[model samples]
Target: MSVKEVPEEYLSGYAEILAEVGRTGRRLTRDEVEGRRALGEQAAESGHGLRALVIRHLAATRVAWPRTTSPESVLAAVEQAIDAFAGGYERAQRLAVRKEEAARREFIDDLLYGRSDPGRLAQRAERFGLRLAHAHAVAVAAGPEPYDDTHPVTRSVEAALLSRFGDRRILLTTKDGRLICVVPADQEEVVRYFAKQAHAATDGGRAAIGRPHPGAGGVVRSYEEALNALDLADRIGLDDPVLHAADLLVFPVLARDREAMADLVDSALGPLQQARGGAQPLLDTLHAYFDAGCVAAQAARTLRLSVRALTYRLERIHRLTGSDPTDPQHRYMLQTAAIGARLLDWPAKEL
Candidate 1:
């Protein structure tokens, strides 16, 4: 409906032609309008307006065309007018599609970034008849997938999929025009539904399959996990039918214990305060370092300390924890614990 209406000139011209042909108390001769009528018919069919001519002239008397009008002139006018109308329809369709695409992208970003409220998300879930499980596996499906960043099929397929299951839970986000659907752990049926929809929608693209997503919360990493799933699937051929983030939590030691991690960081550094004593401040310093990606220079600047002073502090942490601060593994353990400790507001554990 966003399309512009037909031009005034087109409407006026159509009426003018009818008047001219009907003048002198006689219709335009068959010879005068036959060629032009054919042209109008051709225009209608080519523009997906097969029934346009009938609709446009429904009220006019059908005695005969060209009885008074010139066939060549009438055909040219009909052709031009119909073409303009078709253009309006196409433009309207395109605008409506753009609006839907934008909404889809917003939904996807919110799930990935944890930026949206529960109400809006719930609205999407309800509209799609999505049944979100307590434990969900969220992932971004792409590559040979159903769409480019600017596609309409993705929307269509999504609408179809949502409508396909009325009692199930389904939540979706579309980034780069690819769908990120979150389904329940027990909902094998729903995941398959998504896969089918994706394949069907991705028509003419690479074989469509998606990647694993992150767990709830820490949406940034969850999003990364989803992207990695797609990459790994394309590169290593690991996932069947679809990929998921659970594949990446391969290390036992890295599995989280929220409360224990909080306790560990608290005890280890609580009494060792030169900057803030033992655990908490030292943990903050280490986290900043890792988050800045282990760049001591950037870490020092953020900590507002001279490079040499920050280096001395890092050495002290190594001595107290009996772990090398420079090691990637050590940084990971320290940063992870630091986050838990900071979030939990508990002291570090003694190592």
Candidate 2:
């Protein structure tokens, strides 16, 4: 068979193989196989449909089957060429996927960190299904262990989000070992669903949702609020699996003035250090008392103590701090001091 006998458009150098095999009954050389692979890669890189390329090759093979070569030899050569071609095509496709993932990762970093110009960032965001013109809310989930995009919990959360929302202007990604979900502020249900799914999936995990804000900088602010909520939850030993930044706003306000907060801690809790077991026992008592709404029996149950024993501890706290636990005015002072101590991690580390 001559080169002209094969389909011209798709054959490329395939007809050369046929002519050589027809004349010599030889299999494809390594160089010829490599050349075919390179052609496949070029076809892939050029955006030619794989199916179309394969069909073209198959048609050329039929038209240019070498008459002199045994049918078995010709078929074997065709198989080797097709395998190499497919290999190259697959390799190219994988490379394209890796490049795309890298670009997406970079874009996410810039968007979340506010590292790019607002105009440019908003433009880039459109490619990823985000519209920064409207208000957006951020929710973050932190588990017992760090998570990545491929983690089972992360995959489950993504699957859930996609199923419920159908890829609506929602952006979900993992950053700094936590799962972050950003959605339009109006879609409160989406964030709520995410929190539910994330909490359910992470077992010993918790999720925090931040208040909505508008614009590119809003995303950063919401993300930081979610993160801060998580940090506050940990420090304060909050047990709620789903936390809202809005609900926890007071903690941040109370912590704003470091010196004042430190003074409150010293004035209200410092005296507890004089007790037999020191401040921790008294601090635990105060934490439980306030958490139980000053109901002596309930707080006793929480601390696994008799009400009498619990009241004695409260009495000791009152004496040491000069603030009565049952009195409304003194209770405020003690509760605020307790919150400050937790935020400052005082007693464990000097404030």
Candidate 3:
């Protein structure tokens, strides 16, 4: 639509996009509004990496405008940008493609580097020749070791989750598929709502989710809390959508998150605390063993026992706690739980 024919809102939207392009060291011409939309329309049509580039362009424009830019200037800019981008595919490629990659790469770089962005982003999707119509984020529910590693089941689970990103605009990749997500902001609400139900249907591994944030930068933020959600899932065996970043910032009462969990383990095994009287031998030994980094010899020494005697005690512990000392995974879990329990108030029901 001509700048004049375009509704003031839409024309302003085009301007907003241009202003964004300008803020990114990319020029925003009055012609780009029409250019970006036409390209957005094209990306919508290309339906792959091309579409991702299109969204990146739109996102960049949105970022530049900042919701405060006058609608007229924004519209005027959008019209100019669209005029250029819509005119041919080359400008869109040179502008949107590289910018998208830059945005994506910048995003991945921040993730790899442990940095947070103010919601601005860059992309690198064209290198893979993948087209993304839209973008959405996902969080994985992961437990300790085996479940945290790479597995075919995890890959399949991600694939399943990707299918549910509304228009199928997700690109699934994870470090270990353990406590991770794609983090596409576009489908945050839907992804948050359906991820649990969807993941429950998947095979292998357990996971939880945090709400998707606004942009590629927000995606990183979302993934940050995904780690916490994952820890909760591992500790509590939570099977429902029990957490979200969108709500978390307001409360930020995460310190108590694990408190409830610690309480759970305490409740489940609290009675044992009194069995050993003034000193709960099992718990004391468990603490020592864990503090000694699970080294049996060190633990035995700490417990002032012969190695064989420590073995016998551990065997009793196995029978009493059902937590296998020989199993590294379970051993660590119980150890962590025990340490967590120390922070809780163990009620005295009279020894």
Candidate 4:
């Protein structure tokens, strides 16, 4: 059949599909691809060979300036155009996917960092398939080394969280070397389970979970709380794979008033500075003693010291600091000071 014999409607539909692919750089959906295939079949059944019709249509839609007239040459030119279109389609699909992922990451960053207003954040969340109107908690996971979105552990945790939370209600992303997730409040256990799985996957990494809070603003609060909980876990030498903010609430509260904590540490434990060795040994002894419930024998065993040596150390502590660990009131003050010291990292820096 001559090039002019091809139907205008079929040519126009194909042109439109090509135009869309060019304009938006999106891959054709399955339904659209199938529709075009069906059209090819229809053309074949109507006594026009599909390949011939395609070549003729391509020639018809070519740039206005003519270059060739032979049938074989036209066919070759059409084939080359088809190859170029396929290559462009593949590139466009990859670019589209990258753009989409970039957009999602930005939205997650903004939501967690409180960069957008609550109402707008909620709207954007909904647009991104997140339900922010309900109760939620923030969970953060850290590996031994730093990670970003491209890290294997981050991608694995994101996939695991989506499997549990079904994508719509959970927002998962990586920022500042940590994998952060916002999940439903009631799914704390599930979140913890995923965190443990991620930790194991990353070979002894850890995760921290915040207490559940309500609404969009609550997400930001939960994120902050989760970060504080992570810091406290490291400071206090916690061994659990998943640490909860509620469990470490006291540390954050104590850390809030830095000046008061400093004063308490100085007034309660300042005299220990005059010990023969640095204060760390005495501080370690006191910590072990308190951890052993003020039992000298248990503390001595833990410290690998003889009972007499432990007693001498305690006596020296009392002599220097005037706070007898055996006395309940003095022990309370001393314990508080020890806690404050650890919290503030006192004598090391102001913190």
Tell me how far the alpha carbon of residue 302 in candidate 2 is from the true structure, in angstroms, after superposition: 1.4
TM-score: which candidate is best? 2
Worst 10 residues of 1 by lDDT: 1-10
lDDT of 1 by residue, 191-281 (tens): 6667666655665322232332224443345456666656544543243555545654432233356546546555554444545444556
- When summed lDDT is taken over every stretch of 10 residues in candidate 2, the lowest stretch is 1-10
Q: Which stretches of candidate 4 lie over 4 Å from their true place?
A: 1-79, 162-168, 234-240, 291-312
Error of 2 at 310 (Å): 2.1
- For each candidate, what TM-score against the reference? 0.42, 0.92, 0.35, 0.72
Q: Higher-lDDT candidate among 1 and 3?
A: 1
Candidate 1 lDDT at 173 equals 54
Q: Over 4 Å off in model 3, which ranges?
A: 1-109, 112-121, 125-138, 143-151, 158-168, 177-179, 189-204, 236-351
lDDT of 2 by residue, 1-351 (tens): 333332344457787787677777688999988888887787778777777677778878888877773777777778888888888888899999999889889998998899999999999999999999999999999988899988998999999999988978999999989999999999999999999999898986899999999999999999999999999999988999999999999899999999999999998899999999889998999999999999999999999999999999999998998999999988898999999999999799897
Compute the lDDT for candidate 2.
0.89
Determine the C-alpha RMSD for candidate 1 after optimal superposition of all C-alphas: 13.5
- The clash numbers for all candidates, in the given order, read 47, 0, 46, 0
Better of 2 and 4 by lDDT: 2
Candidate 3 residue-pair clash tally: 46
Q: In model 1, how large is the Cα lDDT of residue 254?
A: 36
Candidate 3 residues 88-184, lDDT tens each?
Answer: 4454456776777566655555653446543322334333322222334547555334432246645555656656553444544445435344644
Query: How does candidate 1 score on lDDT?
Result: 0.54
